[model samples]
Target: MKGVDLLDLKKIVVFLPGRLLPADCRETKFHVSATVGFIHIVAAHDYLGILDKLRVPDDVRLYFEYRELVLPQLREAGVVVEEPDIMVAFLSEMDLPEPGSIEKLRAFVQDVGGFDLSYIMRDLQSHIVNPERSTDYYRIMEEFARVPRSIWREFKRRLVVSLEASKAGTPRRPFRFAFPMTDCTFMVASMDPDWPVIGEDGIRMRTNAVELFTQAAKYDLKTRIGVGLLISKVGDHFLLDWCLIDEPWSANAKLEDLLSTPLFGPARERVVDSYHFRGDNAEPGT
Candidate 1:
C-alpha cells in the first residue's frame, strides 16, 4: 500500500462485494463505504491473515515472492471504489434492512440465491415435518418454514462431493450454477459489511461474510466451517484469484455429520495447493 495509489485501490474494493450466504449476513445489511481509515485496516488484515495463509510450495518459495506479495498488496492498497449510499440501495434490494431483527433476516435468507436461501426450506422442515400424531408438528412447520428438505438433500450431495474432493487433490468447487470448477471466473467472500470486492482495476473485497458462511453451511459445502478457497485459471485464464477466510466453530466444538470435510489444515500450504484451481469460466466459484 505504501507505493500503491489510493485511487486504484478504491476501485478494486467496489467491484467485488462477495455475496454473503444467509447466516453470515443475518441481520446485517450491505453498507458500501470508502473511508481511507477502513481501507488501511483491511489491508493490514490481508497482510496478516490471508498472506500468512498462502503456502509457497518448497519448489516455488523463493521464486514466487514478488508475485505472491506484490499483486495482493496492490489490490489491497487500491480498494475504495463505491460510495456508501449505493451499498444501502444494494442492501435494500437484497431485503437486508439494517441488522438485529430475526424475522426480516429469515425472510432474506429464504429469498436470496446461492447457499443462503438453499438450506432454509430444508432446515425448517427437519425441525417440523413430522408425521407424529402430535399437534406440535403443525406448529413446528408454521414456525420454521425456511429451509426445505429438497434443498438440504441437494446440499447433502455437495457435502458428499466436498468430502470426496478433500481426499482428492482438487476440492469440488462450489457454485450456484452447473458450470465446471475450471470454468469459474470470480472468487470472493465477505467478513464484515465494510469488506471489499475485487476486480482487475481494484482490490477484491469480502462482503457480508457472516451470510456467506450461513449460505455455505446451508448448502453443506461449509466454506465457513474451515475452508479458504483458491481460484486459478487454465482453460481461458480468466479470474485467477481465490479466498480462504476464517474457520468454523472451534477446536473444542464436537464433530458432527454436517461438518465432515477436509478443507482445513496449515492455511498457507493448503491455499497454495488449492490455488492451482482453474475456473470452468461458465460457472461461478466463491
Candidate 2:
C-alpha cells in the first residue's frame, strides 16, 4: 500500500478555527446585516460591452440578439439628439467666487442673495444680467449659507453627477427595448449588501441611486434610467430596495406598440466595485 502524503505538490498552512466560529461566540466578530439598493439595466444593444458585464438574463440576451427580427419598426426609431450649449459672457460688475472651497461658495451665495447658484450664474452670463436683487432673497441666501460644509459637499457631488448628462452623446429618455411604454418594469435591487445605518435616522434619509450609479459609471456615458428611493425594512436590517426603471416615454400614442420587457431573473449579481476613486466624493467603503 502507498503511504498517504497530504502535502505532495501542495503548500501547507494552518486552518484558523476562529473563522469557522459561529456569530454567537463572544470573541467572534458581530455581523450586521444591512440592505442596499441597485439599478438593473439592459440596453437594446450592448455596443459598449455593458450587457456582457451585467450578465443580463437569458431573456434579455435573446431579446437583444433578435431585436431587429422581433421588432423591425424600431430599427430607425433611435436618434442622436443633442442640445447644443449656448455661449454667453459674464457681467464684469459682479465678482464670481470659484467653487474651490465651501467657505468661498458660502460667501458667494451670501453676495448673490440666494441658494440658486445656477440661476445666478445664468444671469451673470445671459443677456439679462440681473434678476432683481432683493433683501428677502439675501435673507434666504444667508439662511442656506449657514448650513454645514458636509451637507454642501454632498450637494456638490450630486450637482456634478447631474451636469454630466449635458455632455455630448448623452442619451435622452425612453431607453427602449422591445418593451412597450407600459411594459416598463420596476424592480427593487440592493446595490450594497453591507451598508451601515446611522441608527433611526436612516429611514428618513434618502440615497440618490442615480447620483451614486453615475458616479460609479464615471460619467463615461449617462444612464437613461431613473431610480426610486432606497428603502429598508426593520429587523435583520439587511436590505435596501431601490425602484429601477428605464426612461419614460412621453408620447401616449406609441405605448401600445411596445413589447414585454424582462424585469427580473438570474441576470442580476452584486457589483462590489467601489465608486470612491472616480471623483472628489472620496468617502471610503461606500
Best by TM-score: 2
Measured over all alpha carbons after superposition, the RMSD of each candidate to the real structure, in angstroms, is: 23.3, 27.4
Instruction: Write candidate 1's Cα lDDT for 1-286 as tens digits.
Output: 2446334232212122244635433312223356532222222332333223322122122212222233343345653221222222222333222323333322222211322322323433222212243443333232122222223233334444444443343534343311122121112221221223244322333223322433343234323222222222223332212222234433323234324554122112111111111232322233
Q: Candidate 2 versus the native: TM-score?
A: 0.18
Instruction: Give model 1 RMSD, 1 decimal.
Output: 23.3
Model 2: CA > 4 A from native = 1-130, 169-286
Each model's backbone clash number: 50, 12
Number of clashing residue pairs, candidate 2: 12
> What is the per-residue lDDT of model 2 for residues 123-195, given as tens digits with 9 covering 90 to 100?
2212110224333233223322333232233333333332332232232221111111223222222323243
Instruction: Write down the TM-score for model 1.
Output: 0.16
TM-scores for candidates 1 onward, in order: 0.16, 0.18
